[model samples]
Target: MTAIAEHKPAPPKPGTGGGDGGFIDLVLRFRELTILAALIVLVAVTTAVNPRFLSAQGVEDIFLNASILVLLAVGQTLVVVTRNIDLSVGSTVGLVAFVVGDFVTNSDHGLVVAVALGVGIGAVCGLVNGLLVSFCGVPALVVTLGTLYVIQGLNHYIAHGEQISAAEVPQSILDLGNGAILGVPYLPLISVVVMLLVGYYLRAYSSGREFYAIGSSPEAARLAGVPIRRRVLTAYLASGVLAGLAGTLWLARFGTVIADPAKGWELKVVAAVVVGGVAIVGGVGTVYGAALGALLITTIGSVLVVLKINSFWQEAIVGLLLLLAISADRLVALRLARVLRKRNARHG
Candidate 1:
């Protein structure tokens, strides 16, 4: 008679260092490498179709366009790493953009004050989300969704059918948005700096790795003495602050704002994060990968324009890419499950 083995899978450890950690490191690098390869192929194909697509301005445009999404994706990565989501970020961005733009225009505030206001407002929004989702024990999805509607309503009431225009915005703020330094645009530069900082933190800091542990297995993480609630709250707070910063930059970039600015952007940001190799189910991904994903999405839009393809197809392509990414994640999960089962059987 053959004896059946009971299965038991070990939970991932925060800041783990061993064969397992090395394997995870390899997976992370591989995911980012695949994205870079795809991006290169995309750029090459589009440039082949239209030489002008590879022009200096065209490249800069792609990065500038991706800057906002990259920032949002970085913040989203932090939240998602902890098995949480912030649906309110889109609305938060819209509110900050309009409120900061209006306040700056009326008060003639300097760039520093405008930025401070945007960050502060975003922090308030994030704090509300963190408090509710963390201490109140509400589901993150439901909490963020509710906040989304509430924030959107508040923005509409404040705007009152009015919009901020370039004429009303200060030159210093506009310059920060549109101006380039040493042949590089400020928008993309800012995004790159944020991405690097986040990527380093996630890889180098114990608390940051705890995020992955929490997402991988919250019960296990708690058993390991990790402070799950505090980390989750911090994630939402970071997401909000980044969204707010993005809003202020949005005003500068466009020199215009409406109540509905950035409406329905949450989906795009999620798509970018997921496509960047972050599992929707959580426990894996990097800001570097997420930023590359943003760049890829932006490149796709530019590719359509340079190819003179129908604009409608852009959404279709994005949807298809999202499906593919999700499928890829599912496959990875299956493989991981299989590996765990094998390891369990060996012990059994």
Candidate 2:
């Protein structure tokens, strides 16, 4: 009886994800669960300290602030998952923001044209980064870093020590950024739509899955005839376009285009993606997770303020959280390995 009991199959791990179990597994994954729990705890503590933190205005502020970062983080997820990075996104946004503002200032190119211009400019930047990395065989880090400076330099030169003030911006554009539908802010709504579209493609399409394949094992991806070069290029282009859109929104939301608005934003976006549970190593994370990561990062800043923590401690706290997230991932991985080994040993 004891032997039979010992031989009985153990129930599957809660989120091991087999067949009908996939969605459950996704929710229970250590990384996703950690971020969600941390966010909840942080929110609760902040609300306790100041009930105003959960007020409608406060909630709107958190989501609005998170919108651009969430957009950028989602795009960055695709690139990082494939073992690449785009440091140029910050510069891309700055340049496009100023340029779009400048364009609309004199010509009145209309909102659609202005947005197209920004996205096109960004796509061009992404294309350059992609070409150098994919065809020229340059390291992605080096390429994007160089592009970052090059773009920022261009933006500075174009601005010529001038700024695009709110007076110069079109009201319609600002309305798009500031307006709400059914009491929901447009910025967050825009972010949600982009997130859903990208996430769906990544989850439902073969080409999107190819990105995961490339990140997992480039050599294997090559063997499997994955179009590595094209995919990398597309990834960068998507990132650039999103950054550009963010820049356009930046202009709309702030109505003051400085050459340095998003100067150091790339690091924050990367932090969100990492904290969201997307493996920095490549090929293991969801855009939804990245979005949550953005929300969590944004909320932390607000919570710190609500709790009256020193402003200086904000970045430090973010850094600590990132470290904790990575460590948790490693611990979970190690635990899984041990479990597998023990089970194999018993079977043997």
Candidate 3:
């Protein structure tokens, strides 16, 4: 009888059904699960200390407070996943909020007009940053940092130290921000909708996968014919558009706008994204994880107040969590790489 030849199956691609793909999916899910567990434990401990911490209203408040940050964090994830950053987002939010708020306050523009104006302004800002970083060859960090200051300065110049008060905001806008359906607040509901939509797109589309590929290895992605400039521009634009929407929501939620309404918020958004398991060096993360990170961070602040802990401790705790997340991500990446190498060797 002729000798039979054995044929081994080829290794699965990075995002396919088996091998590296499965392992990566597991790790990503685990990161989100870890954050969810921490959130649960935190709520349990806080509720134990103060039962009111878990009250219906208190729970609603937590979601409500996290809504804006969650939106910002989701936006940031798009850019970070592409190995880029937008430090101007906070300034963008502040500028959009003030400009939109002022326009609505002074004009008879309806909600649609207000929203469009906000989004348009944000897109313009994103366009500027994208052009500089993607086409002009400027570093993302440097471009966004420069735009951050420029936007802040423009906001200050326009505001002239003026502020938009609750009395000036339209009741309709306020309702959109504060009203609810089925006992859930509108702010949180809107945020959740956006998060779900984005998460789906990123997971289900080829373009979405390209973002990860570009972040993972830019040279490889380029070699594979991915449109690097277009994708990066799209990421920045998405982030800007979301920041604009968040600004509109901010105005509605607070019925107030100042020149520096979202000052220093960019750092918090970065922290949330990092803590949510997004690798700082880029290429791995999800909007779901980023949203959970925002919620967890927001909850921590609330917990500290409810537990009567020093406000100062809140920053320290967040910093510690940030460090832990970075270290964990680094270790996990190294280990996963090693495992994959070993597995491939054995297969060979």
Best lDDT goes to which candidate?
Answer: 3
Cα lDDT tens digits, model 3, 22-73, are 6677877888899999999999988888999999999988999899999999
What TM-score should be assigned to candidate 2? 0.88
Candidate 1 vs candidate 2, TM-score winner: 1
TM-score quality measure for candidate 3: 0.92
Per-residue lDDT of 1-348 in model 2, one digit per residue for the tens? 465444633222212311123433453366777888888998887888788999999999999989999999988988987889999998999999999999999885778988999889988998999899888999999999999999989999999999998888888888877889999999999999999999888877878877877776687667666788999999998998998899888888888877768988888888899888776767667888899999998998888888878877878877887887678656655665676688789999
Model 1's number of clashes is: 0
Cα deviation of 289, candidate 2, in Å: 0.6
Question: What lDDT would each prediction earn against the true structure?
Answer: 0.86, 0.83, 0.86
TM-score of 1: 0.93
Stretches of model 2 off by over 4 angstroms after superposition: 1-28, 332-348
* TM-score of every candidate relative to the true structure: 0.93, 0.88, 0.92
Ranking by TM-score: 1, 3, 2
Per-residue lDDT tens digits for candidate 1, residues 90-161, read 999999999999998899687999999999999999999999988999999999999999999999999999
Error of 2 at 45 (Å): 1.3
